[model samples]
Target: MGPDGVDKKILLNAFNMNSVGHICHGLWTHPRDQSADYARLDYWVKLAQTLERGKFDGLFLADVIGANDVYGASPDAALLQSVQVPINDPIVLISAMAYATRHLGFGVTANLTYERPYLLARRFSTLDHLTGGRIGWNIVTGYLDSAARAMGLTEQIRHDDRYDMADDYLDLVYKLWEGSWEDDAVVRDARNGRFTDPAKVHRIRHDGPFYQLDAIHLCEPSPQRTPVLYQAGGSPRGRAFAARHAECVFTNSLTVDLTRSIVADLRRRAVANGRAAEDIKIFSGVIVIVDRTEKAAQEKLREYQRYASPAAGLTHFCASIGVDLSRYGPDEPIEMEGTQAMVAALESITRYNPGRPWTVRRLLELMKLGARNTPIVGSPSQVADQLTAFVRETDVDGFNLMRAVTPESYEDFVDLVVPELQQRGAYKEDYAEGTLRDRLFAGRGGQLPSRHYGRRFRYGAGEWADEAVSRQAGRRGT
Candidate 1:
């Protein structure tokens, strides 16, 4: 809600990962923080119930395949401080969570680099089938060279090349998910001695530079044929890819002007790509610390900082942008090589920052909370004011709220800030009924709109996609 007394509901997702220490480098030591229980399903179950109780839009789970080991050109810093190293698979925990709570969407992050499109598509379809369409995919290309090396590659692929690969990968999956079978393909008839009609299921034939496939989709059509698409790309090439495929776009920037520019550019690109201006829901990552009073919130932040591990945070950053910062002195200027892994996050320290270019020393200091996103610490009213202002300034639909601690951080936001926003007419008092996509775009149907690239392949649409896919598949080498 604006201080001027206007009505607006801010979308909120509790940004988390399946690990002890996620974004906030070393706050696992907080007395009230039970992040150590990340390995247990009960922890996630409780978290899901809490988010649903608060009427949050989703529980966004972030994941990575490899360690953050680029700061000292070694894995010591990351492993020692437990900075996102012991991460588990986020997708595996969803069923239990979905079973525990209804209407709470799960936006799980999965890198496209390591998995095959056929297997990935089937798995997501299964999840959507099980969760009743309350799922979203945060499409990402692997960023860490450590991850690449661990997976038997000599090094990670070039920046733009990765997005190119992802473009091809998504097209194949789109066909598998959206083109393979009709909604009525399953015809259970005991008298006819048949479970499914084979004629209604089409085999998807894909041939491209990076991959080739001629196969039918393994799973039946779920509630949402394709899960809601979420992307967090900030590079021009990455943005182009996202504009083509994403339904929800996530961003993180240091300043309001830069974030606003990114949002405007994304919408303009979406429009250019034939999607409507409001097609994508752009969300900026934010850290909100709220309490009964401003001073209490400030003290809470200071206490959280007492246990922070800046080295772990910087090390994570180093691996992200492909630069080792441990050797550079305070006076040195950084040359950033931002990759597909949170391009906006990498830029916050170097290229796109509104203030002075951050030196290694300064960057280490600033990343104490592992905050690549903006952090707002204040009372409920004050936090609500800043939140409304941020939305107005950036034109982003909502936020992926990063945690300063574990469930305590979220509990405080719900207890203090949620009420204030509700009073200001800036938060939902109750969640709308439907699938995740339905909840996201209320009143709109659960399926992708006709304008979306993937929808061109729905069920029996052929020649239209046949030509378009040929051109897209040719882009494998472009």
Candidate 2:
């Protein structure tokens, strides 16, 4: 139970990656795990149906285009553990999942550092049309140097510079999505035999430092012209970027106070940028293991640990924070530099245990339960209570739920934990109407409201400011 009386609705998303071993590392080795079936379309379809049945908000998919070779200065360890290297494209699987469920939204992650803004925007628009607007884009600027090298770059760009590039990228996409087409452009008048009003379609001209475009948008405006933008970077630069662009922000924190502080800072930044504080939703990573009794839950946790892969965990950490953890001893403290991600990760650990210094061994132990996010091990009722308490204390909008094992971990959550949360009125009983954006901002419509910066591009009645100015000048007889 949350508090004495809490009526607020809690959003829930199933956090998964398009790979065999995601957050729980070596969990694919579990006999009951079906993560090996990630390549099969049926696995995704069945998962989508199950989530919709539980009234989950969306399925958040993480993707990576490069391998993790930062650890041990070689790719052997990462390859041996299957740590996000041999991953499939996340976008290709969404159509099949969308076909299986109508209400469930899909949040697919894509790294903007490597892809062109123009092409990426069209891909999302097509997906929005195909899924009837149940699509979201999880924006990531990438954190791995390996990804940069694989993309034909010498090395990764500086942290803040990537955000600057993303800012320009977003500006161009906004022009295409919101400015290029009028609301009534698609007349489809069969009697008049007019497919669209040619005069209503405007060409967008963007000549920025990073990107250049001088043409009309290729696709017509879909239900939600621009899909809901989700961001998952937690560093200082990352947070600043999210403040400006993210409709939903994903974070991982060990304490309620830390999470609350970060969320407050993001809201304040959003307000400073002229957007409403509530316009952006905050989702924290959470892992849960539940059983009939606390003893059983503990047993399950122990069983899962048996399959934990320390090598995979280290590989992920190395690539993320830009550190080579293999150079240090198991008990040696890591001294990393040149990256904000490293500083943030180190600070979080030090904050948790001020007296004990963080070492390679300590980090591996913590990641066994899915990175640094807190893990709840108990009966269904007990887990629900903890989740409610976490939400009440942190004021987070929802959770991006992680799993200790494949379909089994998610299955237990749906069967045991969802019922308990439903009984307590903490989780949704049923879904609301419209696209992913509509469901996320339920009372709000499918479109981005006027308050959002993206709305500045929406053409109104084929008479935008420029055209209005031209008409006024003509009337003045200049």
Candidate 3:
């Protein structure tokens, strides 16, 4: 039970990416680390099985389309340290992982800026079908100018402008996922010689500012018509967009007050946007380093630090905030300007904590574990106490646990911290029944909630509002 005597369970998702270096930049060099085997399907399959054994809610896969080249205006440093370059597609790894586990959910990140809604809708639906509704999408507008250049654009659109594009993209996808097929559209009737009822399958026609589509969704309705929605934008515009559409929000906070502020703001915005206060589950990114004893944990941390690369972490950070930190002196104040990457990242250093002036020296010290986020290092009890207090005080629903040493880091959490949390009634002993959305929302159902913006595009008993509008536009030759 929580301090309020409420049995509020803390959710967990193993945060990782399909690359040698993920959040912890240089830990791939650790002797026991197995992240280099990321390309192997068996690696993910086994990892999924282990997470399911630990009763984790999901495996959140982070992805990047291009190299981290903002530092020194080249990809050399990132390539040398393997800082999220040479990253494979995250979506391709999920089906195998799902097949290997019964309950663990997969939240795969995909950038909307480079993908077509019509095709992306089909891919997610197919995964939902294969995983028995254990699928989610982390919506992101690409932050890297490298990605934009690779996509044949001169540069990324303005930061807020990308969210505007995403809004239209989501609208188009919602139509394809929810409005294209009614509940009874698919039927196996040998006598009638009909596998589907044509009348029930509606054609989606969207002529939005960023995208235009005039076709039916390719696949039939999966267990969940639309996958669970997640968003990680922390800017004002990002939060507003998330409030309107996201079922879950992923956040990273350097302090409890910041996390509390974010959690409160997200709930307030969700309610303001015509959703319930509990509509969006907020998860903070965290790293935990626990051992059988407090001294042993500290020793382990020291060992991990010897193999960590602070410069590599800086290279990754430079790309994130869209500012090159290499030019700044150790104590010089780094300016936050120019690029359209993650505005929130820049604010964290330059504005969030003014008392402690941020400098290259401070950033390197924070990256002792090769990650910007500080890890909670101690015995199981100590780690559990901090984690429980964090959730209780900040109102964050759970954590997206970043990996420091791949399976070793994950295994330690499951074996040590999970049991401690479970003993305190702060973690689930077993997963609830249903799809990813249903499980996350505690058996609400395998579809988007009735009040969600996506539901507006759903094909219900009467004429969908959009269909009526589309017909009017058609008659006017629009």
In lDDT terms, which candidate is top?
3
Residue 55 lDDT in candidate 1: 92
Q: Which consecutive 10 residues in model 1 have the weakest lDDT in total?
A: 1-10
Error of 3 at 42 (Å): 1.1
- Give the 10-residue window scoring lowest on summed lDDT in candidate 2: 340-349
Query: How do all the candidates rank in terms of lDDT, highest first?
Result: 3, 1, 2
User: For all candidates, what are the clash counts?
Assistant: 0, 0, 0
lDDT of 2 by residue, 59-178 (tens): 999987677878887888878888886789999999999988989999999888899888998999999999999999999888777788899998888778888999889988988898
| Better structure of 2 and 3 per TM-score | 3
For candidate 2, what is the lDDT? 0.84
199-221, model 3: which lDDT tens digit per residue?
Answer: 99998878889899999999999
Off by over 4 Å in 3: 3-6, 461-463, 469-478
User: How does residue 321 of candidate 2 score in lDDT?
Assistant: 74
Please report, as a residue range, the 10-residue window in candidate 3 with the lowest summed lDDT. Answer: 460-469
Give the top-scoring candidate (TM-score).
3
List all candidate RMSDs to the true structure.
4.0, 2.4, 2.1
